[model samples]
Target: MALIILMLALQFYGVPHSSMFTFIFSGVSFEEILSRQIHLPILWVSYLIIPNFIILDAQRILSKTHLIQLRGFQYSHLQFELISLMGTLFITIIYVLFSFTWIIALMKMTHAQIFSFAGLKEMSSYFLFFLMILIGLICLVLIQATLNLFNSVLGIILPFSWIIFTSFTVWKFNPLNGLMLLRYSSYNTIQTFIFCFIIIIVLTTTFLTVVRKKDFI
Candidate 1:
């Protein structure tokens, strides 16, 4: 099984291309990975080592918490715990990796200028990303409050409401301007900001609502 998994991972990571080291990502098949001219070393590290590190770290955290195995909880299961733990790890890797990736990219691109903003116009890209994550948290809280009070289908209503509210806010304030905060967080052009948003939301929600409240007996 380990050998098979390794083979599969080899397929997924593709291979490193040049000394520049820019083109490598997850894939499920050789054909899918073929689109990027990734070379051999990057392929091995990204596909096998990285995922193993993520899963192992997740497992360690879960072992420490042991919340799901607590006898008194009304909603606790090993399967659910495993999934949640994996989600936690995956989201962590995504945000941190993207953040560092962009930071380095910015450093390299701008020659390590030590980013600082002096404009009275709009927030810097890093600051904007921070604001965006904070706003998402605040909106999530407002959604939960609204759902609790008004008894709406929060799973559906919350996202729609967030979109509408964010749209209104964007149209009204126009703080971000034309500068995309997302650009700093991705190496590949195909990597979208939506993933970062999802990762941030998941991480924030889980930390605020779940892990903090869970009893680890």
Candidate 2:
């Protein structure tokens, strides 16, 4: 209900739809959709609720299966590292693909049509888009840190530092360019952001649960 209200308000404010972010397939353009303006409910259905469902399920699996927990070390365990590494790798690979394709999309949107090789410098105008990747990374660290803080204040100090790092990145960077997306395609970076965000959350939770099984004593 709250999400629906927020979505309606955003539409009233002309937020411009941002549902184009999908990780299922690569190299596909969103040109086929017939709806000029889609219902806001579609945004929640395609963008928010479904993906979070996956995260919730992933957490359940990790907790029950003990995928990340293992017997080793005093400060850290093999399971924790493995789980965190999974989160890191998931974020890294998605970031790489998003960074590459998003830049390509941005270049195609902002600058005139040019071969991929031609618009390298002008494309760099949006360094902040890349900064968005940190949004996912920092969010993962923050969740773990906050959890650790509840258990052991000292454990979360590093993750707390990430709050500062994320702030710094977001402070100087604002690349939403909401209008450009509607003009070019039926989507925006928010799709990419939310998709990646859920993945990071799953991995982070998995890592924390696995690692904490050992160090949580």
Candidate 3:
């Protein structure tokens, strides 16, 4: 309900004349999508809300003992990681589709074409830019899952606090800045994607290590 309300408000009031691409990139031209240095509070808030759902989905996956203990279907820690990842991707995709649906509808009603990039190069760049953003979201989800496995309270408090803090700060020196898609122009798409991919790898290994070290009660 809250997400829907925010999406509607952002569409109508925030960057009403902008294109669907604005939600991902900050600049006016395709080339600047990865080089512009502007902050988008509306996009920031929308992206922040998504991680909360991802965390909840991670928690649900981690909490299910029956799913792990099914007869003849042994699930290892790697399997758990895969399941949680699938859940994260599913949640993120749903949010993206919903946002685009509302955006296209609003675009039609206003009879406006905010940003036009018809060239093959522009389309591919936009796709890569969008992929990097999704990778960041996946990082957050995996981080939440790993934290939850270590300690439940820290799992909830840490990720939520990070989101709250990042939303207010304009500092670029922050280590977790990759999660801030609005300012993604700080680094190119492939660079940020590689950085996020490394984070995911580390988190997955840590999660697996923790799961293996613990004794089942």
Candidate 4:
């Protein structure tokens, strides 16, 4: 809750008043918002940090309870992974929904023009873009957690490094590049979504397999 508020405050402060509506309604992708390309270093960093908050909290819960839950409670590895994945999904959904809701509210409050038909139509596109980003984040989180299960240091480094690396590069077919796929990539929304879906499924399956095999001491 506090972190969401902090993100709101940062957006309100870092973004110029005259450009707030443009920033909201304009073609600002969530990736750009998270990257240093925005020139608002603090805001971009804060955006990236939000996912780490989720990662750290999820890790804490899993680490603290995995042993007891598996041994004492007689939970199967598949059962435990399912519970953890469900928890992650729940938190991700809530976080993304709340973040976007507040952003939309802010846009509406500041730019009354959004109530118009055209603005509302444009808003739907943003929703789809956000959904893509949400799925990408989920994949990244799961991949990170899976790595962390094996080695803590590598877990944080690889996933985050990819995010930072992608932010700096401009790849047209980058499935993770939500708006870029529409703007520059040959792949359309459906194609990008298919790729993302595949990635998520692969990552989830791999994570579960690892959990089953890993001797969590």
Candidate 5:
């Protein structure tokens, strides 16, 4: 409920479509401005809120004795972890779908210039980029969950550490030339898929190993 309201507020006032490129010397069309503004919040939501929710949900599952009892049919920590992963995945999918749908609906209602084919292609590219970032975030959240399971303090520290490191990297090295994939890349379809697969595999493997070795109460 709070998230929904916050998203609505951001849509109205966060970044105005008309003034997006005001400082740039090169003139940008209204369509480009509208598209950029529309997608900006989508990127923000995926990058900021989703990961926090992932960690929070994982923490709830681990900390709540009743939830543990209900979910732990076999009294297995692996089972609990798996359940948490599945739940987090489901929530992430729903959020992605809803955000995309809402953005499309808003564009249509507002008669946004991005309704054309070119705009749609651009939007599709952005969506793909968002999904790639989301996959990485999920992996990071899983790792955090594992840390939280091991020691509550690590859970709190790791997230802040990651945020600070990422912020510094983005500040020092622009996404266009940096290691961040949040910006669109020129990789072909096969290359992109392979890259995403490798990252997901590495992160997931590490997360699983950490969780598997942890001594859960």
Candidate 6:
């Protein structure tokens, strides 16, 4: 509900939709602006809200179970991670669908050509971008889970700090030159995919190791 209101306010205030993409790229052309308008909502939701939700939920679950001992702790940890992944995926899909629908309505209002080949290409790229971010979010959540298990304070601080640092880097340095976790969001599709794949593998392995060694109580 708040997300919807924010979106409406942005639209009502005539915020340049492409302005969001400027954080990722140095300069965006007119055609790129159109493409961005079709996809920025998904990026907004994934970057701004999803990670916090996952981390908070992990914290809530941990708080409740800290004093309880399950017969199969390892299995329970795996299930928790799996459930988080599924929930994130489901939310991402629903948000993306809503974003697409909103974009279509805006296009119709402006009488933009909706069935054009270029539009279709942009939509395809949006889905690719969505997939990359989805994978990255999963990796992030797993890392958060591991941190939460090891040290709850660090778990909370690190993810929030990473996000703040990423935003600062995006504003202060050239995104192409800066090394940040979210730098991949502005990279080529293949590069983003490879980076996400590597991060997921490393984070998942580290999470499993940490969960196995750490005492839950």
Question: Which candidate leads the pack in TM-score?
Answer: 4
lDDT of all the models against the reference?
A: 0.36, 0.37, 0.56, 0.58, 0.47, 0.48
Task: Show pairs that collide, candidate 2.
Answer: 68-79
Q: Report the C-alpha lDDT of model 6 over 1-217, residue by residue, as the tens digit.
A: 3364346445544433322222322222234444553223234433444555544655447546752554345446555555555565566556545544555565455444443321223666556544654554555565566676667677656655554444333343322112222333344445656765786688768866665555353
Q: Please list the residue runs of candidate 6 whose C-alpha ends up more than 4 Å from where it truly belongs after superposition.
A: 5-46, 57-63, 66-69, 72-121, 170-187, 215-217
Better of 2 and 4 by lDDT: 4
Poorest lDDT segment (10 consecutive residues) of candidate 4? 112-121
Give per-residue CA lDDT, model 2, range 103-216, as digits (tens): 345434444232322111334523333444345444544344334423434334434343333222322222222112222222345554565567567756765675666556
Candidate 3 lDDT, 73-117, residue by residue in tens: 766555655566677668876665565456556655654454453
Candidate 5 least-lDDT 10 residues: 18-27
lDDT of 1 by residue, 1-217 (tens): 2343334334434232211112222212223234553223333223223332333333334544875465445544444453554464455456445543554354344333333322212235445444443333333333333232233344335444433333223232221111122112323212323434554466456544543344342
**Model 2 misses residue 102 by how many Å?**
6.3
Report the lDDT tens digits of candidate 5 across residue range 1-217: 3355335434544333421111111122234444553223233333444555545645554647566575556545566667777776677667656655655554444444332332224666556644644554555565556566667667656655654444333232222111132322453233445654675577567667766775353
Winner of 2 and 5 under lDDT: 5
Rank by lDDT, highest first. Answer: 4, 3, 6, 5, 2, 1
Better of 2 and 3 by TM-score: 3
Q: For each candidate, give its TM-score against the true structure.
A: 0.27, 0.33, 0.64, 0.70, 0.59, 0.56
Give the deviation of candidate 5 from the true structure as CA RMSD: 7.9
**Which of 5 and 6 is the better model by TM-score?**
5
Q: What is the C-alpha RMSD of each candidate to the true structure, in Å?
A: 14.0, 13.4, 6.1, 5.5, 7.9, 7.7
**Model 6 — which ten-residue stretch has the worst lDDT?**
173-182
* Model 4 stretches with alpha carbons more than 4 Å out: 1-45, 64-66, 112-121, 179-188, 215-217
